[model samples]
Target: MKIYVMVDIEGISGVYCSEQVTPASGRFAEGRKYMTEDINACVAGLRDAGVDEIIVHDCHGGSYSLNWADVSPEADGYICGTIGDSRYVDIDDCDGLILLGYHAMAGTAGAVLEHTYSSKRIQNMYINDVLVGETAVDAAIAGEHGVPVIMVSGDDKLCAEAKRFLPDVVTAQVKKGLSTQGAVLLPPEKAHRLIHDKAMEAVKKLPLIKPYVIPAPITHKIELMERCQLPNAAGKPYMNVIDGRAYSVAADSVEEARMRSGG
Candidate 1:
């Protein structure tokens, strides 16, 4: 089976500061190591499950945070930022998707590093009135392609969010968010083990989990930091201004939503 893995940083174990998630921050290097370890564990587990091809997408800021030298070369993957296009889950040909090091939606209580797209610009995002983050958006894309999200690894809030939308999908929580900037983390080794084991479980039960589907005419509400940014943000067609800081868009499906968001 083919699997697509998307990796982010905020939800990795021991990441509780902005510095860890930013490229300019000194602590980002350490966060990269932690993120890499978690991904490696998941890859190992997927391999154990007899997955034939693994396509990893570095989904964090500008992507390219993980050390490519350390990753298994056998796995074909793409570093984030390399592609100028905004395609979140480019899993058109993959069978399953795996979300690694994801985080909670913006404004969520007790969620570590919680923020949708940008902490500076995005105030909140909703799909059909359901509060969602990157995970939810990407899962929708997977659903559009008839692919199931088999596993997700992140903090407790992120895991809980995933379970709320996808009850049967496997989740590995490496930390518990106390705030957007604070978290109680598990040791890297322990977190890695949990991710690996859970990934294995997810793959084994992949056939049992249903793809998350959204009804036709998908509606999205984006709450931006500045009202003036609305026109630019709504450059795509069919985007209507609901109010200051809020804009609405309609698409035929979730994948179309991603396209509208330039994801």
Candidate 2:
């Protein structure tokens, strides 16, 4: 079995500040250590379940939070960078996708370092009139390749939000949040153990998990915090600009919207 993993740092255990998520900051290394350990446990669990191949991607800001050399030896390969459409690279060959160290959308109460794709650029986004975070957006993208998201690991709010979109997905919750920048973290060791068990269990039940899909002829909108962030073709035939800040697009699917926006 083959699995693809998309990992972000903000939702990792012990991570709840800009110093941790910001690349090249003093706390960055510590944050990466937590992320690496959590993913390693998941890889170990998948291996025990007979998984043969694992592909991991660093989905943190700028896609460079993880040190490729420190990634799990069990993984077949690691994606170190992003190119607009990089999130779903080689997705078709995988049976399942796992979201690691994820968080709730920006402004979500009791979530650690909450935000969508960009905390500074995006204010909020919607697919078919339902507000969505990165989980939903990215899941729909992975669904285009027929891969279901079977597992996820993050804080309490993130796990709850994920269940709403991926009802049957197995999740490992690592922390309880007091505020966006505050959380009662699970010890690294404990968090890792939970991840290992959850990964194995989710993969074991993979066949029953279905892809998270958005219906055809999808209508989506992205409300940007800054007007200047709006795409150049915002007012075209299938797209529109609201108040010069929010942009809406009508596409056959989420992938189509991303491709059209050059995301």
Candidate 3:
């Protein structure tokens, strides 16, 4: 009955401006508050759903985006700070994973704050030739460990992306993205309520959900935004430099491929 929750800031309700998610910006704290409340709503729902243990992870850049003090007391534990590449830590032991405040992949039309893993470095990412976002990446990691992603929350595009990647996943769409920095938002209270309801619904439907497995021998490909971002691995055995701005890594598992790619 344990569940893991991964929280990001870009897609939270009322968060539309890029400065709101930038740690150096004066508006960053406001975004953190919104993220914390959204997670609390999900936490409350999970608790009501009879989940025994809940763990929340700050998945945003630097992992300092969560207002931990404002998070629900019901959550059993929290993981924050520089967690490095071991993003799937302890996910194998959880019954389900929930993605909160996630957004769409890079180049997604009308997706708010749209970008893949790194907005500055990565222009695009694909697994088995299918373009994906953080949602699919996390889902594959969980799937590698036999954990199903049961719920996701974000803007309309993100929710739709979740459904396309993870079957039977329940989603809470808090806003409708009009552009990269703009969205038609739901009132905070309404968004939180929807999250609460969807969280419970996701857990309730868990029995019908399945792990989203991207078959073995995964080919992790990355398209860098700038040619200079490509690492100098001219003769590396593990990597195949596609071009000046692209590279590919091959591995038997999704996690291994991601780790090797430094994703």
TM-score of each: 0.93, 0.95, 0.98
User: Comparing 2 and 3 by lDDT, which wins?
Assistant: 3
Q: How many pairs of residues collide in each model?
A: 3, 0, 0
lDDT by residue (196-258, candidate 2, tens digit) is 999999988999999988888888888888877878873478887667888788899898886
**Using TM-score as the measure, what is the rank order of every candidate, best first?**
3, 2, 1
CA lDDT of every candidate:
0.82, 0.85, 0.90
- Alpha carbon lDDT of residue 88, candidate 2? 70
lDDT of 1 by residue, 25-67 (tens): 8888888888777778888888888889988888787777988
lDDT of 3 by residue, 70-100 (tens): 8899999989998767885678789999999
Off by over 4 Å in 3: none
Q: What is the lDDT of candidate 3?
A: 0.90
